[model samples]
Target: MPNPKIFDLTPPDLSDYIAYPILIVSHDAGGASVLAAWVERHLDVGQCDFLLEGPALRYFSGLKIEDSQRHSRTSLVPSEVSRFACVITSTSGEDVSLEREYIQQCRLLAVKVLSMLDHWVNYVPRFCIDGRLCWPDLLMVNDVYAQQLLVAIPGAPPSLLFDNYYLQQQVAQVLQYRKSSALESTQILSRRILYVSEPSTDSRYNEFELLERFLNSIFNYDYFNTQQLQVRVRLHPREKLGKYDELMFHTFSEYSINYCKNELYHSLAWSNTVVGAQTTPMVIALYAGIEVYSCLPEVVEKMTLPFDKIRRIY
Candidate 1:
């Protein structure tokens, strides 16, 4: 998939963000919403500002969290930094280079930095960039598994770790929402399958090759030939389908191939199985009680995903 053509890559105005005492920064929709929910519950007015990246900001445009879902005092913005209090950010460890500018600004401002774990991978590089370790004052992990993995990093201190109550609650709430929506669906003919696609720019794996392998796995399956399922491809927020246009046009003529625009929770609700490689949506799928399968190449096993059994496609 190609990147978005119309996104505003420019950094948002940070003045509004600095007005609040606490700042919450997130680059992904899941992390931003989770942080937003947390801010709404714990922080008071003038206490916190929720800052999101361009992709995350656009993805949350129409979705409204109920008054009850948020605290009375919370500000949501598109940028961040400052000296008032603390700055909290989440990272899955994949895009450390991209966040350097923001992180640097926070450092220069001497803002207390708190980093939240997005998933159980890239432990060392996620926090330790440019040979500097313990970049954040506080590091939050979602579960015991994350804690274990993070603490094992050579020089990472144990005292810096804390449980991510906000993420835990978000996971529970998302699961409940998906579970409730399942009863409302009336479509009974086509068993839906969600294919969560990631960008191929990363040096670790080729998205095109992995996609080909996944397609071959499904086409060779005798049950898939029965045409009892519908395949819905959900592109990563930062990804576009331009690269897959040719392949999609040439194949799956007998079956339905849809590009999902709804949120991942909704996508999980509409699907029976989720396929991906080291993606957080797979974790969300499992939380929503949907089956998940791994489609990563053999050399990509370095990805330390949180799943217990990520069944390989081939």
Candidate 2:
């Protein structure tokens, strides 16, 4: 079978988003945030539809999505999606098995599909099935490295590779929004350390050990014991609050664990240092001029985007 035709269409104005809505999907909160930021910039309130699942529901809970337009993946039927002008999704490795079926289904229905790269790692894993790739009609990526990787796949269409200008635009827009919000906040920390935590769901890296190492790194630091350094841990959407509460309360009760209140952009603005393994927020922090440290040990190779390559962009 031949590869589907890929189009590198120029994005239209906000008016096009309202007049011709699209379906947005993502499996993680961070990925969903990126999508939401783009939607906020391009689509008017209640103008678009979403098939949010996994962490996306939690991340977008605060946004005002109409009940009619907002739906879970399971709730979305073929007939419903067939009407969409196009489908846009942040590729997910865990959901690929299901996504492949959905992709095939969409193909039969003649609905166009687009996949957005959430990170640089797993470039091939997210879309491949049984050594064969399930290609979308359009692919959005931030850098040329990704474009090169995607086009190398057998039967891949190079024309499908387009830059995710929305993500870059979001960074600027979010930073400006949070900068103004920061002026109104009275809370002060001599040194704010934002610890972005990822779930240890997979056994590649030990969650407890990672946390222990991070804590030790902080406590043993020259200024940590002093009143100057303050640390706050932001849990991933997939992480349970109780796990961290128990871990921190017994080992280090002083550290604060935040869930919904910890907006990624606001935390990045408030923090002097952003520490994490390999998360989208770390890259965002790096772009925002905040210092970042990789906490994941050597064993977890291929699990995250290469920070070295991402740093080159800045």
CA error at residue 32 for candidate 2, angstroms = 2.2
Question: In model 1, which runs have C-alpha deviations exceeding 4 angstroms?
Answer: 1-20, 58-82, 92-99, 105-110, 128-134, 157-190, 201-204, 221-226, 241-243
- Which residue pairs in candidate 2 have backbone atoms (N, alpha carbon, C) closer than 3 angstroms, thus clashing? none
Cα error, residue 234 of model 1, in Å, equals: 0.5
TM-score of 2: 0.72
Among these predictions, the greatest TM-score belongs to 1
* Model 2 misplacement above 4 A: 1-22, 39-48, 58-66, 72-75, 79-81, 95-99, 128-133, 157-189, 201-203, 221-227, 254-260, 300-314
Worst 10 residues of 2 by lDDT: 11-20
Worst 10 residues of 1 by lDDT: 69-78
Cα deviation at 267, candidate 1, in Å, is 1.3
lDDT of 1 by residue, 1-314 (tens): 11233222342333323334665566665455554544454456345544555464653343453343222113421133553466767653446343444455667666766665656655666655577754565555556676666445666533233344544553576566656876336445566678998776468678777776677667657434556767888888777656676556576555567788876667776777789887777876776666788888877655567567667665
Global Cα lDDT for candidate 2 = 0.63
* Candidate that scores best on lDDT: 2
- Assess candidate 1 and give its TM-score to the true structure: 0.73
Please, what is the whole-model Cα lDDT of each candidate in the order they appear?
A: 0.59, 0.63
RMSD of each: 10.1, 6.3
